[model samples]
Target: MLKIQEIRELIKLIDKSSINEFKYENDGSKIVLKKNAGTAVSYQTEEVPVQPVVNQAPPAIESAPAAEPVKASPEVQQESKAAEEDSSLHKVVSPMVGTFYAASSPDDGPFVKPGDQVSKDSIVCIIEAMKLFNEIESEVNGEIVKVLVENGQLVEYGQPLFLVKAE
Candidate 1:
């Protein structure tokens, strides 16, 4: 049987590698991992038999195809360049899989927007998971540089939802 830690390592390995899918089998257990077209990853593991799993080194990150260039308006281009050059920018990632909400309700304004100031513990957004609405906070003092996800969009765990330029 594969331990939980082993499974986590495999997940991290697969996420970093260029390969899109991975499979492994031992005893009566079978494991298959597949990455989605978006940022999410999913995997399946079957029942285990008697054999112990052996550990192996992680796979190296391979070079993938170059992406096509994106064209944008002049103002957007400047903002993108500035964001790329800023080293103090911090990404606020989702802690769990959920639908992203820019505000508490549809009629309410967003908790924060681009150029808005935020401090540690500020509730910048909400994540609805399993019927629970979780207020996501910014852990660093910063200015909201960008919002990566749209309201009412499904977000995966560890996906970056905002870019903040730390003060």
Candidate 2:
């Protein structure tokens, strides 16, 4: 929210200057001061425009300055890493409709995890079609982002197996 004095100051500036518009931004909040060649000064934000109390004249109103782009933080990077370490890194998709399997046998461990680095042709998992198990290969070299299908789940041809961020 903009303070009343701040609004008045902006109006004063607009009144004195020849510039038709002026704006300032801080974090999410913004204040825009606008005036025509000869008109009343008005302030506006992303929400409602703040109309100045008309002691005498109507003020000019214009939109606030454009918002700056948000920057990614370290926490976002760590989260992305954790997601890559998770099973979502498998970039290879299913070539045919079948059931997804982690290993060749029931007693064996999973073929891959989130953090496991994979390359093109890496056997990430298995897709069983018509009682035949086919080894699924990784098509991209990258860290995993997410696993779309679970083990033993029925998978369709061309289904996404994992999301991978390229190295």
**In model 2, which regions exceed 4 Å deviation?**
1-90
RMSD of each: 14.1, 19.0
The whole-model lDDT of each prediction reads: 0.79, 0.70
**Cα lDDT tens digits for candidate 2, 1-167:** 66789778778877887877777776556665656544544445557655653444554688888444233467755664565465533446789987889788899987777777778778889998888989988888886556656678777788667777767
| Model 2, CA-based lDDT | 0.70
lDDT of 1 by residue, 1-167 (tens): 78889988988988898876677777656776666553233334454343432343345689877444334568765765667556778989899988889999999999999999999999999999889999999999989998877788788899777889898
